[model samples]
Target: MTKTAIIAGTGVLPGILADRLDETNTPYVIAELEGFAMENPKGRPVERFIVERLALLFDRFDDLGVEQVIFAGAVSRPAIDPERIDPKTATLLPVLLPAFQQGDDALLRAVIALFEDAGFSVVGVDSVAPELVPGEGVLTTAQPSQDDKADADRAAKVVAGIGALDVGQGAVVAQGLCLAIETLPGTAAMLRWVAEVAKTCRANPNGAKGVFFKAPKPGQERRIDLPAIGPDTVVQADAADLAGIVIEAGGVMLLDPEATIAEANSRGLFIWARTP
Candidate 1:
């Protein structure tokens, strides 16, 4: 039997994955991380562990017979406490600690390498739920207008530029202006900020809503950590007065397609998926 485990962090992504696994009767363990800085997790039978005790976490997983792992949800980078590291992980700290200075994509790759070196299969969330990958094209009744399409195109280029530097994967372009770029707080926060800006311009005679673009970082390992767009994501974008969302088709995951599309349509918003 293939034993799967979820190295979950904070966010709805963990819960989404958990629900899918449960619906399919897939047995799994949740290796929950400590802290609320990045994500508030939702799952059952979770074994909480700090990054410092990674080796101990492996021991617990081994006891549970967890052979394969999925890194789910967003985990922000924090200053790791070397003193908290178990003696086992400390032995490998020389190989691991350097990742702290690298960008998120590089750090994620290092983490994946750690798991693989342990004889565990590190898989992407899409590997377990391939249906979540969005298809290329407009996914809603209201497609983007020419202006919105232009903004999306600009946003895509901006996101790609930042991505190449391992900066971020999302950007908001409105009224021919780049409103905001996603930062460590993540995409939702960026949308929220954009929403605030849209409110300020609500009375502007020439004001127009915007579009949020998400794509993979340049040269980013796509097997895991691809950008995710879900129902909550649509709601955030809508709140930002974004006309629609532009995602990299085949590069992003739509966690709740039915609900997300329904919500987008209801809000008079659109979800367009384009290829990179």
Candidate 2:
């Protein structure tokens, strides 16, 4: 019997991967990371301490004879108060602390090392859900206006440059000015911040409200959190009156691609997936 374990990070990716594993008659166990939320507001996710979760995750894998581990979903890097770490996580803290504070890749690489050292083969979600990847084209029915396209192109360059520096994936741009950059608060919060700025800008004589672009890191770990967009993104952009959304082709994951495109079309929001 083929067995696998999904160490869930965040969002719908993990559950989707589990469904795929189920179809193949492979038994899989889910180990949800602490402090990450599912895409669905109504969904309840199992959360546990990192080390405790990893121990149980491996134990389940051992019990089920799981040979493959799909690292699907987003894991937020929170400011860990060393005093609060559990016994299991505390033991790993001395090493994990320095790498984690360095940057996203450094921390993730350490996480992968810890798992691989314990004999788990971690795989990317792309192996199971190719359809989720976007192609190079206008993803939404509403094609970008000339101005929207130019804005998107410019914004993409900005975000991509920021990504190369390991800063963040998303940026808010309007009228050639970058309004905000994504940080620990994440995309939705970034969008909301842009909306607030747009609201304020509405009163100004200049039409300077900005749209958003999300891209991948220069040499991103695909198995980890790839830039993600979905129906909620459309709703947020529409409600905020954002000009458009730009993402890297084959670099970002559109959760429920068809539905997201449909929502974008209905809301008259432009979505561009650009390629090299």
Model 1 lDDT, residue 229, Cα = 85
Model 1 alpha-carbon miss at residue 158, Å: 0.5
Listed in order, each prediction's TM-score against the native is 0.89, 0.82
Query: Per-residue error at 156 for model 2, in Å?
Result: 1.8
Question: For model 2, how does the per-residue alpha-carbon lDDT over 1-276 read when each residue is reduced to its tens digit?
Answer: 656667777668777776677677877666666676545343534435454335455555677677777777777666666555557655666677788678797777787777776688877777677778878998767776776666677788888788888888988776766777887788888778767764455433456345778888877777777788999988887766776788888888888888898888887788888884
Q: Give each model's clash number.
A: 1, 2
Q: lDDT for model 1, on a 0 to 1 scale?
A: 0.82
**Clash number for model 1?**
1
**Inter-residue clash pairs, candidate 2:** 10-74, 174-210
Give the Cα lDDT of each candidate: 0.82, 0.73
Clashing pairs in 1: 10-39
